[model samples]
Structures are given as C-alpha cells and as structure tokens.
Target: MDDEPEVVEAELVEDDRLPAIAEDRSPAVLLAEEDPDAWLPPEAEEDVQAGIPKDTSRAYKGDMDRFAEWCETVGRRVMPAAPQTVTAYMSYLKRTPREKTGRPYGPNSMDRIIASIRSSHRAAGFEPPDTMGARKVVAGYREQLALAKDPAAQPRKATPADRRVLHQALARLDRTTLVGKRDAALMLLGHALASRGSELAPLDWPGSFTELPEGGFRVRVYRKKRKKWQNVEVLPDPELEMCTVTAVRDLVEALAREGHTSGPLFMRIDQWGYMGVEMTRNGEPIGDPTGRISVNGASDVVSRSIARTGLPGDWRSHSLRRGFVKSARDAGVDIVDIGRHGGWDDQSKALIGYVDEEDSSGERNPLAQIGKAAMKKRGDGGE
Candidate 1:
C-alpha cells in the first residue's frame, strides 16, 4: 500500500522490554527488525512507501499479524521490540500446532516471517534491529526441522514427481470430458512452465497464451516475485495424448464454447463437472460469475489426481513446481538456466532436494534448466 499504517509517534515500548539479566549481559537481538508518499520526498523516501513489493504486501501483513498476535498473547508491544521478546516470540511460534508436520515452521518459512518483521519495523521508522541472537534461534529451529524431515515425521508436501510419476498421476483422470481436458491441460502446461497453482487460473487465452504461427503456444507469465511479465514457449509435442499444444488447443476451444475465450484460461467447472462461464442454476446464469477457478480449486485438481492414482498421501498442490526442479536437476541442467526458466532471481530458493549440500549455492534455478522431455512424457499420457 502507498500509505503507511498509522502508529503512535511516541515510542510505547520502554515498558515492554524484557528484564535484563545481570549474569550474561552479552547483548544479542533476536529477530531482525513503513510510510506514506505524500509529505515525504518521493525518491529519498521510496523505501518509506513502496519499500516492499506490492505482490508480497499480503505476506508482509501475514507475518506481522502472526508476530503481533504472539506479542499480544505475551503482553508485549510489537513496535520497538526487545531482543529477548523476539526470541521468546520465535519460541512461541515453535510451540504452536503445526498440522501433520511436527514443527510449526520450516527454515525458509521462518526466515520469510523474520524478514517481514524486519521490513515492517524499518518501514515504521525504527532503527535497523540487531539480529545477533536470531542466528541461534533460526539455527535451533533448522536443527529441529532437520531431525523431523523424514517422510514419517513430516508428510512432506506432495513429493516432487518424476516423469513417470507425473504421467501416472495424469493417467488417473478421464480426458474425454471438459473437466478432464482442462485438468490435463492445466497440469501439462503448469509443469512445463513450472508454475504455481495461483498463476494458472489467471492465464488469458489471447493475452497470456497466444497462438504461434509455427505451432504450439507462447505463454506470457506474470511472475509473483518479480512482478513482471515474460513469455515462455511451448513447442508442439510429438505425442498427441498429452501434448501441451493439443491439450491447450482443445481446452481453448472448449472454453470458447462456454464464452470464456478472452479471459482466464482455467475456469470453474460446475456440479456435473462441466465448465461454465457463469454460475448457472437450472441452465440460467446466476449471481456473480464464478468461472475463474481459485488457487485452492486448482490445487484440488492435483490432490485428486494423486488420490485417484494412489501416488502418495502427502502429495499436494506443490508437486508440479517442485517436480520441475527435481526433474531438471536430475537431468544435470545448468543452474543459471534453471533460474531463468523458473522466474527465480534467487537460484538457491529452488526446491531443496533438487540440490544436495555440496550444490546448495544460491546460484541455481528453482525450476527450469531446460528440458521439455519430462513435460512431453506427461502430455502424451491419456488420463
């Protein structure tokens, strides 16, 4: 948001500081710790207003909200936070219920919240908070996470799929109908592009996926992290059953019949598992349009695919994107190329197992290092 959240100009945190321990005065801040455009000069105070990217603002709020909630529970102030309080907050987070997974947060998820808290504090005009103690807290959490990372300890998010596994998941669906065709197309293109479920339903026929003279599709991608649009090419597959080209072509035609030609490529299918441009009751369009499939709905497609095929109980929405990295890395593709294809500026952020400890340098792709063979194998399978 352009405007900063209002805060009391006077710091209300002196009373909130955790009591200092006399025995070990060695100081260490636990977690590393925004503004409006108008009164502040535009360029100099850019960080004050547009400091955080718009796409991530929701995440920023979520992190701070979580932190704020914890602080409230312990009767501490959120702003001008104390080193001890931050440490305590991390501990609280660790203690919270964490689904089938034993730990509340992964190292990466914890780091994201930590960064968000720091950013929020800075945006509020606080000093750059010392993070001396955060290293220990995060390290501790990481160690705990490592111990519990086994398949039994953590269900492990829909395990990344290899070509055979991916196609096998695809094989569970019935491709003759609209829902089948759309799901098939979604998974095929989604894996080929290494896209998140959130990115799939927003794709436009004419805008995002454009027809190319030579055959296949040119998919324009709006990256969530980068907040920029770029095109990725999908060539015609030699195999017809699972070809990205044919799958999408059939979907586009099917959607066109349903009056969804110009907008979102993936639309909500109704009770009979039919795609309709609007919510229809007794064949009549009703209320607001519910045609655009939600991220959750798209995710269910993957989950259902896994369930029907009996692939694995832990498999969920992230399988395809994660699979992209695992498949590419297994193929020994270059890291930089992978980053470019995956739209990740930070190659180190790719799915963890895709690279072992020796290769975990922050310089590889999170997904695409270039290999359509896996996706092609998927596209050729008849669901």
Candidate 2:
C-alpha cells in the first residue's frame, strides 16, 4: 500500500494570490501563487486594496507584522497559529499594559486588534474555526454587551432650560457677518433636519440647494446612513419662514457673491478672512476624521454655544429631534406621519412611545368625566 502524501502550505500570501494545496491525505495545506482559475476583476482588486482607511491599514499591517515576529520567536511558521496559541495571545494582550500609556488595552481596541488578526487569517485563506461556532460566540458577546449597564447612554429628552441656554449661545453671533450667517444657517438646517454631522460636513453649495415654487426651497441631503440622496421640501413656516429664508438666502448670496459657487457650502474661515471652499485635493470635501464630529458635533456646537451664551442646561442637538417629535405630537399629527418625516421605516412602536397617554385622550383627568356624571344624576333625580 502506498503511503498518503503530506500537504505543505506556505506561511504568507499576498493580495490576489492563492496558496497551493497539496493533493495528499495528510491535511496540511500549502500556500501557492495566483491561480488563473480564481481571478478577481481589476476593479474588485482595486477596491479591496482601498477598502480600509490608510490609518486602519497601517495598524492592521503592524499587528500582522508583530504576530509574525512572535511566531519567529516561537520557531513556528506564521501560517498556522493553533487555536490554543491564538487564545494564549488574546490573554496576553488582555494582561499586558502599554509601556507608554501604562494602561491595559481598552475593550474596543482589543476587539479591533482581534478583528484585524481574523482578517489576516482570512487573507491567507486559513481555515481557523467552524463558522457556526464563531457566530454563536459573537452573538453571545453582543448579548452580554446589551445587558451591561452603560452610564453614558443618551437621555430620552432634553430639558427646556437647555434649549434656552443653547439659543442664547447662538444669539451671540452677528448674522450680518459672513461667518455668522453661515453658522446660523448651519445651526438651523442641522436642527431642522436632525442630520448627522457627517451629512452636513460635506455640504455642497449650488449643487445641494435650489429655489422652489411657492416661495419655498428644496434642499438635497446626501444621507450617509442610507447611502442615497434625499430631497427635502422646506416649506415656509408662517412663524419663522421669513428669518429662515433670509438666513439661507444670505448663505447662498455669500457663496455666489464672491464668484465661488462650486465648493463646500460651509468653508472654514480663519481670522485673516481668506475665503475659499473647503475640499481635499481629490475634490472631496474635508470630512471629520473622528466620526464624533458628525454625530456629536451638533451637540458640541450647541453646548459650546450655550456655554458662550451663558445659558442653563436644557438645549442640545438631540433636543431638536426630540422637540420636533414633541411638537408634532402636540399638533395632533399621527405618529406614523412623524416617523416618516423622521426617516424611520418601522416606527409603529416608536411612534406609540412618543404619544403621552395623558395628552392623547384626557381620560386621565378625574374632572373630565365628572360633568357627564353630574348631568346623569340630575336627569335621574327629575325622573
């Protein structure tokens, strides 16, 4: 009887290259170069190369390099780190403190490192674990997180005093100035749209806004969350339409007033008054590097403005969204209608959550049914 041949696998694989697998029964897999049969499209290859951010790519590469070094120290090939070895490494990372920071790796940072390691393994086409088992582990982790107490969870509503303070902060700006006009417009649009910071960070001037019929304006929002363009009709509000319209008009006029019609709507203006549209050399607008600005920027802006205005703690960006919901409820608009306006697809429960029971039927008031009872008693007495 012939002996089964052992499989030999390579340690490292490059992009678009496949590792050679030995045909023999000894389960060792070999790493090989590009297989003509499994070719990826040029565009797909390019996308893969560019899928991760530059910084993220660097960090991933560094982690892999470190892992390779560790493998070398243990006199083992980098391709196959046994499950036990990987678990040990994970424990080491948890126990190890940063030499510079003197702190253990944060949970989020550790998660990212593990993710990078997994990606590296996938890139090399290594069969590490059963997919179903991995999924169960991930699901359990998420469940634990959901049950964990998070002190930083956002509040459901903002106090009225917070709004007053935020308004005062915004009031300090002189709308007559170009920067002031732009900031004012940004605040109103952000508040009204409840837009994430990233959504407004790259606002295009002439491309995004247009005049509409009936003295209204149409604003095109590039919703990053939906990855699609959304059209919003800004109908004139009888109460504040004039001022809002003026603010928008002022911003538009400022953009075209200086013969600059094709750049970022909100250009960063330094103290020297040098004005140009904000964009990267690739013609993409400068986006917030730390995603915090997009979601939390509005809150920060509102908070800072409030602090500057010296107002109390009732106003916030979230207050804007909450206020809109509250106002709609007070105006007798159906919850479904409000949800649609708020970009919620399945909002049945959410809408119900917003409706204050007391505000809805007035049945909670003891005196409300008392009048009918008194009339019934009088009729019975007469009989």
Candidate 3:
C-alpha cells in the first residue's frame, strides 16, 4: 500500500507582542484593593460603592488594573499620570495585538479604557490627565483604518435571527432535553423582549417576570441605555410552537421539577444535564450558584441554537435584538413604536440607522426603482 501523507495540525502560537501583567500595581489601585476601612468608614464605603452599577464598577476596576500593570512594565506612574504617559499608553494599546484575536484594541474599547483611567484618578482625589492628545491619536487611528478599508473602522452588526432562522433553530432543538428547553425559552424571550444579553441575564422569576391577567406576561427590566426601568408586555403568539409564553412555561415546569423555583431565569447546565452549582477552580469560585447565567452564557444560548440553522452572517446575543427590529420594520411597524418596544430612545441614531438601512434595500431603493422604470420605458420603445 502507498504510504499515507503525514498529517500535520497547525497550532496557534501565543502573541508575545501582547503585554503581560506586572507584579507591581499603582498606589491608588493598591489602596482601593487593600482595605475599604483604610479609605472610608464601613457605612460611607457602602454608600460610595452603591453609586456605580455593579457591571460598570467591575469594568472600571478591571480596566484600571490592566492600565496599572502596563504602567508597571513601562515604569510610569498610573495615578496622577502625566498626559504624555497616558498618550504613550494609548499608542501602545493601539499597536499591540491581542493574544487570542491577534487584533489591536478597537477605538470604542480604547475610549472606555481611557474613561476608566480618568475615573480611577477622580476617585483617588486627583485631577484627571488631559487626554486631548490621546483623543486626536484615536481619531487618526480611525482615519488610518478607513484608508486601509479595515472593517474594524465600522461597527460590527450581528446578523438578525429572522423568522426563517428562528423556525429552523426551533425545529432542530430537542425539546425533551433540559438544555434544549432552556435554550428555547432563552431564544424566545430574547427575541420577544428585544433584550440585550446583559439585561436578560439578571431576570428573577416572579420578581422581574410576572404573569398577566390577559394572556402572556409582563417583564419589568432596567434599561441600561435609558438608565431607568421600563415595563414591556409579551402577548402570546398565534403560533403555539413559536409562542414565548409556551416556551417559558415549559422551561419553568422543567426547572421546578429540578427543585429550582426562582433565581436567574436562565442558568448553566452541565454535560450530564445537572444544573450549575457552587464550584471552584484554582481556589476561586466559578460563579454564584444562586445567581442566573452570565451575559456571555445568554449569548452562547443564542449562538448555539442557531449554529446548525445554515444561516449566513455573524450571529451573537445581539442578533435576537437586531432580529426583532428588522422583523418589525419589515412588517411596516413605525420606527417610534419599534424603538419604544426595543427600549431605545425614539431619536436614537443607532435605532434610526437600522430602520434607514432596511428602508434602502429591495424595492424601496430609489436607484433600483429608477433602473426598473428606465428598463420598462426602453422595452416600450419610449426612451
């Protein structure tokens, strides 16, 4: 027999250009991490901590920590940092590629990192560094990306999970499995509510979600964009198989059988079908056993559901929200109504952009219509 060709697998090598965490941290971060009593009394500390949302607070801390580590490597002061040092940091972040993605930080991400650095300085009772230079550099970076025709220059939009995708995903799901039931509920609720993964992750059964006297349910959610709570109604769909209420009902009943009455509406499940529990890895707790699934987990549900649906374009958690908007717009739903249901300000440019883009395609396109009219005239020998 002929010798088979040697098969070799390609492995991704870690990008050494990516910065590493340093042992030393900024003095302000050290003070913040050491002890709350050292800075403020217990009562005052509690009030101070409550001022910022938990997610924002965690993000700020993480960003600052990374900045502090970078400062240590460069032998620069993080707190009371000079504008030049800040500019240097921004430049470094812009040029350095991430180990996993092999891409430099995008402009929006860099902006948030800069904001975090400023917040850390303000919290430490120091004047924030002047970032005019850094801002200009970021603007120049955007221009460079535009010149290079880099897709990163534009915002990445998720593929909308239209009816076809939803139908395929729903049909393929094994409703008998616990994971399948949960995935069904997650996908339905995500699409019906037009909710972000972050908003959907913290739902508490019978607390945030409640049954209505009329069919379907009412879900009260805190809109992060609006910084206020909004009540949204979900009516039963005409199609029983695609109804959000039915999906939720089935998932809740299945969960009750497992002795989980209330907590996070969506939760993690293991390969063996056991619900996620308090667990540790490397002596650090993985996640709160009493808490619901993480934002990423909610996204995973959407992605997993649609993976085998043979759809085109990139899909993620945001796909459900975008899908709702696109589907509603296609049905000739008013832009204002769509924005209201989606928890977006009626005047929001982001929301309007979606509507405007959808309006420009197919028969709605002015150029396309003109082309068709000209063709008809030519065919009639009138041109």
TM-score of 2: 0.57
Candidate 3: residue 377 Cα off by (Å): 17
- Clashes counted in candidate 2 amount to 15
lDDT of candidates 1 onward, in order: 0.63, 0.53, 0.75
**TM-score for each candidate, following the candidate numbering:** 0.69, 0.57, 0.78
lDDT ranking from best to worst?
3, 1, 2
> Model 3, range 1-383, lDDT digits (tens) per residue?
00011111111111121122234554344556666544545576466656665555655666677887888899997667899988998899899998979999877667767777776665554567899999877888888898999987766677788656788899999998889999988888888888877778778787887788987899998776567898999999888879999999899899989988877788888778888765679998887667467777777777778987777666777778888887787887888898999899867987876664767889879999999999999999985
**Residues 224-314 of candidate 2: C-alpha lDDT, one tens digit per residue:** 4345677776666565522455667787788677666675676654345445424365766664432212434445454555556664554
Q: Which stretches in model 1 have alpha-carbon errors above 4 Å?
A: 1-56, 96-109, 145-158, 274-290, 328-338, 345-353, 356-383
lDDT value, candidate 3, whole model: 0.75
Q: Least accurate stretch of 10 residues (summed lDDT) in model 2?
A: 1-10
User: Model 2: how far is 355 from its true place, Å?
Assistant: 13
- Considering lDDT, which of the candidate structures 2 and 3 is the better prediction for this target? 3
**Residue ranges of candidate 3 with Cα displaced over 4 Å:** 1-45, 353-359, 366-383
| TM-score leaderboard ranking | 3, 1, 2
Quote the positional error of residue 141 for candidate 3 in Å: 1.3
